[model samples]
Target: MTTAETTGGTTAGVLAARQRSAELEELIRKDPGRFRVLTGDRPTGRLHLGHYFGTLHNRVRLQELGVETFLIIADYQVLTDRDVAERLDEYVEDLVLDYLAAGIDPERTTIFAHSAVPALNQLLLPFLSLVSVAELGRNPTVKDEIAQSRQSAVSGLMFTYPAHQAADILFCKANLVPVGQDQLPHLELTRTIARRFNDRYGNGAAPVFPEPDALLSAAPLLLGTDGAKMSKSRGNAVSLAATADETARLIRGAKTDPERHITYDPAARPEVSSLVLLAALCLGRDPRDVAADIGDKGAAALKATVTEAVNEHLAPIRDRRARYAQDLGYVRRILRDGNEIANEVAQATLDDVRAAMKTLY
Candidate 1:
């Protein structure tokens, strides 16, 4: 696991994190104008609990707040690391279901796939010029991903996905990105690219791109049960679509320290800390506070608490997911409409980009 995964705690612990949250809240609350927001997930597989506590919950909240949000199903990005073309559609569709199940309203938030927006690929051409190879290599997120890849060497597409991500955000003129605290670096890189493009090509006129701010989540991303990251490959993830009994079974079988006292000391008690992290995120309390409350409690009680809280959080989502799954055609239509919206938004941005570069015929 990377340092980000190891440091399993909420953002409330830090002063700068609080300031950033305040700034983002001010933007979300006080700013009357429509704020363009962009965010998404890769179509690797079904999203898990880590996804909810980390990012998806924020997406739902922002859209409810009336932000003009665009949620991308980054289908093409799935090809970056793995050759899963045959199963791409399956993963993408399941990802959409998870998004909708998580309360992302199709009427309010435009949800589209990366492969559907052809023009989105064009933005990467010029965006690729704004950064250096060294900069891409230096991206902490990318480095972490590359380090974690099973493949011996990172592919070119994998290396340049950040540039593609910039295209994902800038193409829609997203001025704010909802991200975890660990993802602040990637957003900073996007800001740098936007700044570079405006400085070089805008010629002291209207800036073509917005310097997007990172709307950081107050909760830290939860790790897998085994103290590793919460990913499918690790087999440590609990899916959003998992049955209640299945969830309980997984939590029951999860690892814990032999000492059995539920403390939030991540360094000494990583496995137990991970459960505490999950419970704290679910209950909206500090991990230390949670640890103190459950002091000297055995692992059985801790596991039961995490399982119950997680199930409570997932109950509504499961209800919505079942209803949405009943009519597959309706879900497809929502994705199609979202595809059109994404295409239109992307084309307009492409036109503006061509005009700024004087490349339009």
Candidate 2:
């Protein structure tokens, strides 16, 4: 195909995704109970603003809308690249704390870790059989993960990451997953596996799984303080757990352009524009308007603007976080209850799978 054809096709795909997402939002608003969402994070470390606005905030919104939500900690997946077992316990609890602080209600959502649910992990075995080695490798997300990890070779879990995610989604029979454009490929793989599984085993009856659709986030990617993608390892992220003073200090040191005149041209001034964008997200305004508000202000003034907005926005969440931190036992109970619920649901799904395949004793 010609370059024009490829570009046109890509543009069409993006437009279609955006339309579907809008439709899904409408459906969720009308009858949120009809949708089940399976989305999560790897407990590698603290949750940052990128995570809060990019996905966490959406999770809370969905739960409040009465959607059946399942949040997996993805504790086992953390070992796919590195060994952080020493702090794994701490990290898991920290994630729960952040979730609560960010308004994730345990009463409304199911928050669990797979390591505590054997049946959920057991789904991985059958899921692996439904996918091919080449298909797994073709997943762009897995390829990027392998490349980024810089490992001499990919581990089995790393190679089968997509299938693992499929199990995570399918076990709960989730019909909607919140994701970014980059993560569309992962959801596609999950949809493919769900279709293939039903084709192979459904025997002209009810399908065993629902192919989940992508609820693409409307939020733009929040960049790090250094003008790069916000990441925990890069040390550019503003952690939700950070104190008010710490948040101010981090934003104060954020990178910005040398130009005295502030603007929100991301293509040309990524660093400055990113700070403006962050402040804009907190203030619920357009980045360009935020820039216009800071016209002629130097980077110092821009940084100050961001610092104040971010801290003011996060004050309530941090207050909630500190109060929750005082009782780790309550956090632990939430995880425990979520695990019990997950095990029940996963066992029921696994039984259905066995029955569909006629493998049940």
Candidate 3:
């Protein structure tokens, strides 16, 4: 989806995007400085390669830079469009293991499930009042989600996910949010809601929340083996839990163009380009460079190369995930400890919000 479709056909994204600096990413690269960041993913399943290079990898890097990072396992977000009533616990557990396997340190980063943070959810009640149905419906990100989920009757929760996201961002008082090109509109909505809340209620002394800026990642959009969007629900994604043989089989079966000579033109050959992007991510090289290396090599060679590179890269992650899976007790403890820390921060933010609005009575 373009900015037109993603930003709800408004200039809100174009305007708010001015503050989102690629320079900030460069700055972080050079100095490794500290900033408070709030970023997360819905606990639908084990994160795939789309996640590793997209967001989860960035989360680990940010934490290592001493930046105060909060990783939210948005378990509640799963219910926004679909029902995970039976598999919610299994989903949450697998997500936590994926976090650990991907190197998200529980000691350094507070990785809490959204449902575990009651105070955070409570903040959503007041935040819901701050944004209207029109405003929420106009959210391009939400609209795109509703469309993708194929839900004709949009749920109230799905409609107001941006507001819930605003609550998530503001509750942590985050100043930097690491996101991709697709998430800019949602982040812009968070900024709008934060400014709206502060202007209305925090005009007296101090603003309660700082509008967070997008810390753009270096990775591009990763497509699944089928050259479509990488998603578990679609059954096209390469799971982080996939063994070497499984990964190889998936890559071997991936879609590629009929061209005899491989090239990296996403518009012309999206299938090959998707594999090119994946290769670049796995080996940390330019996609164009990878394309050149596969010169004269046919589709078979291209798939073989991608299969080898991906398996080599994900081997350690899969191993670590297996180790974490064995110790479910340890994983539960990590979540519990993270919940305590997250609650403290969330409750403090909610208390401040109540006091600012004078709704504490």
Candidate 4:
């Protein structure tokens, strides 16, 4: 279904996605080699707890399942709505460190930067032609991004975000993409582009690309300490690389309601409930159960509980991060190796694209 037609995030939509996810999981469990997964993040800043729970953990799980995984750093995408290129290199390395610390093995998953793969970017030219300006404008994910960026006039890159993302997925011929509900529209656009490209250019030959399916993550959206969606730009996120003291300080300052009695009412008291939710996610307990355990304990006890749970859960990851941080050369080499592999894959895909389109002279 097209993004315009489907009611994204509705009960029905989520149910459908869950069903598909179940089927995909079974397929991967039985024969992981049958799928290739493409997933990534824009290196806007250091990844936070939201990244860890929402997507990073899943990437590691898929890799351990023996699936071929391609993780793009999306460095070029940083210019889409904001210009934080000054710290681009630092942010990219931080992402690599976070990935490694979070258990994304470079030996199993190919981790590369978008700017480092030329043929991948080259595919954007033909991809742009297959999509429409209106469709791109109507994309819910693009609309949300523009709203969040608060740009008065959207840049060309921002306008073409979906098509560029399509290129990112299709370049490696990846058959699966890990995503959250909000990202479903963007993935649908990628599917549309792949279908159109094959219909127009395949000319009865074997299709050059797979219409990738979403391996939907079951993790709930993690709220920042400030009770809003976790975001690095907002200064509310707890980075995976944050020191234990820093994490404690941040959670201690989190915005909780003045009410001494705490309960899990996300609608009524989002701040208090967010803290409760964080503790629950870390504790592997239901939010209601966690809330009940902290019954009438007030915000101080809640924050303390959350702080301890977060730190304890992250202790091992932090140790690994510290070790990886000391070896900058090794980290850079991992990126270099990933970029080499990506370049090779992208070239082969581009060659097929050219052949399918009869553009080979």
lDDT: which candidate is best? 4
Ten residues in sequence with the least summed lDDT for candidate 2: 1-10
Residues 180-251, candidate 3: write the lDDT tens digits: 667777787787778778899986778998877776566677788877888878889898998888888898
lDDT per residue for candidate 2 within 201-283, as digits (tens), equals: 98999999998888878977778988789998899999999988899889888888779999999889888988899899999
Superposed model 4: Cα runs more than 4 Å off:
1-12, 150-152
Ordered list by TM-score, greatest first: 2, 4, 3, 1
Provide the TM-score for each candidate, comma-separated: 0.89, 0.95, 0.92, 0.95
Q: Residues 69-169, candidate 1, lDDT per residue (tens digit)?
A: 99999888877776455577778788889999998999999999889999999999899899999988888778888887766777899868889998999
Candidate 4 similarity to native, TM-score: 0.95
Clashes of each: 0, 0, 1, 0
- CA-RMSD of model 2: 3.1
RMSD of each: 4.5, 3.1, 3.2, 2.0
lDDT of each: 0.83, 0.87, 0.82, 0.89
Q: For model 3, state the Cα shift of residue 143 in Å.
A: 1.8
Model 3 lDDT, residue 123, Cα: 79
lDDT of 4 by residue, 233-264 (tens): 89998888898899999999898988988799
lDDT of 4: 0.89
Error of 2 at 112 (Å): 0.2
lDDT of 3: 0.82
| Candidate order (lDDT) | 4, 2, 1, 3
Looking at candidate 2, what is the lDDT of residue 283? Answer: 99
